[model samples]
Target: MTDAQLSPLRAEVREFLRAEIDSGAFTPDVDSWMTGFDPTFSRRLGERGWLGMTMPTDYGGRGRTPVERFVVTEEMLAHGAPVAAHWIADRQMAPGILSNGTEQQRRRYIPGISAGTVYFAIGMSEPDAGSDLAGVRTRATDNGDSWTISGTKVWTTGAHIAHAMVLLARTDGTPDDRQQGLSQFVVDLPHPDIEIRPIRSIDGQAHFNEVVFHDAVVDSSALLGRRGHGWQQVMSELAFERSGPERYLSTLPLLRAWSDHLREHGATPNQRVTLGRLTAQAWALRQMSRQVARELSDGGKPDVFAAMVKDLGSTFEGDLVTAIRDASGIVPRREGGTHLERLLAQSVLHTPAFTLRGGTNEILRGIVARGLGIR
Candidate 1:
């Protein structure tokens, strides 16, 4: 169906968000998908059948198309809803589990994820490797029917409160084996041998963490996908991860706040032109992301296009923060300030990570180059 046919669904999500705001359930903020962690709000999305729009109906999902899920996700991020609680699970883990997880794993995890009551964390980065998934040093020892993992995963997003974590480790080879012998596991959180230590950011939030597995044992069933196939699995997952609306929309709240302020206080012609250009750029980026969703739905792997979206999207995100503040000439305040001031403050602090997370701009550029057979 064309986007026009999805108008009703889009309107419904907007209305629900309207009701949420009217009831004082949340105050819209910038980069909500990254920073907002309201479990109650996430549960409310689950109750509305909005959490698992693309998973199988057999697993409690709505069984909708990727485009439909795209519509819902675009709305949530644009409106700055508190979706961080279920973001990872619903966005990537559900599809990962459905694609490679065993039937028992699906039955046990999918329903709670669809219900928004269960959360997951990404355990890909290690202290030594950073965003280089291939340089992983975290190793897991095979013990017949189970494995004993003994390594640390750094920058583990949302591991503390997560019900489970999807971790990557070197299972059958040494760290020198870049992409070989790597495997994934579904490590249940709060395990006796697993330690979660929070890492605070410049914004004073522990959204990132360090997850150390001290000979932690997991049944062979915890393995995700096939042994030594994690490189392939994770590469595909990054295509999904990088091309989402979140990439371009992280600093949207800053624009919204500034625009709202302009509506009240008025804007000069130059400001109007700048805002118009930025808004137009955002619209173009949205269309690009939406096309990637349609491609994924059609069983196409547009990783190259996904990389473009991420590379340009993150640049847009960081530039947006600078543009809004420069256009207004208003000082950003960290606390006890106007809505625009506070939002700008948050955006300024977060701008540093815009190009770093998911993958660095340098790495993303190389992906694009390699995709074109230039490297």
Candidate 2:
């Protein structure tokens, strides 16, 4: 959608957020995408037709373009709205399923996903496989009527609460084969054979999980796309996942809070300059992200470009936090602190994960290098 077309929708979302905040329904939070999970808020967004704006109309979406979705997503992040409950399902899983799932799978999952009633978590990262996803040791064996999946996944965000997970397992290859013979499965969660344990962060939140599947049996029909195509499917999905407003907006709430604090307390000339520089960087990155979204809408992968955007956007996220903290001259406190102080504390705790999640900067750099034939 063009800027003129998007203006009204943007205004509509901003107004909705204003009303929600004015009523004290939810507090604006730093890293709200990851830590601020509110199912009620997610359902509210779905009711407004904001959760699955890009999906086809037949599948309960608004049949909007990615650009329209981009407007709503950035606005939500900017306002620090709690979107964690439906973030994963709406952002990538639904798209993935639509692109690579069977008709039965699509009919079964898409409606609930668009309605914001179903949630999903990624099952790619393992204890030993962080950036090297091809090295995952999770194995799935065919059992005629069902697939017996066995292994553990670590650093799984929201797995404990997710209704299902898009699990990647080695169905026909060894670790030596890297990406070959891998497959994806839609595994329902909270089953008797699956165990979920919390991995607490420095902030004492259990958003991340360690999930173990001990012969977890899922229907044979749960396989997504084609067997041995899981790597390719996941790569396509990451292009969608890594190149969004979320990459740069994770610390936006903190940035806005600090900006307000400066406005109230007065900032020095140097502080103003630093804030301007950060704002410019964020604007440029947003343009880059929007370009990627447009590309996805046009059926283009733009993987390398996506990786580059993610690398730079994540770096900027960390830099934004540091710059805001340095300029504000307020020490972050975990308790009994001002809003700015609390947001700063939250930002500091989340800084390290900024570059790590959705593929590390180190891995992203490699992707860019290979794409440019630099390596």
Q: What are the RMSDs of all candidates, in order?
A: 0.9, 0.8
Model 1 weakest 10-residue run by lDDT: 253-262
lDDT agreement with native, every candidate? 0.90, 0.93
Report residue 328 deviation for candidate 1 (angstroms): 0.4
Off by over 4 Å in 2: none
Clashes of 2: 0
| Per-residue lDDT of 199 in model 1 | 95
What local lDDT score does residue 345 receive in model 1, on the 0 to 100 scale?
Answer: 94
Give one digit per residue, the lDDT tens place, for model 1 in 140-164: 8889999999999888878988999
Candidate 2 lDDT over 239-274, as tens digits, reads 888999999999998888888988888989999998
The regions of model 1 sitting more than 4 angstroms off are none
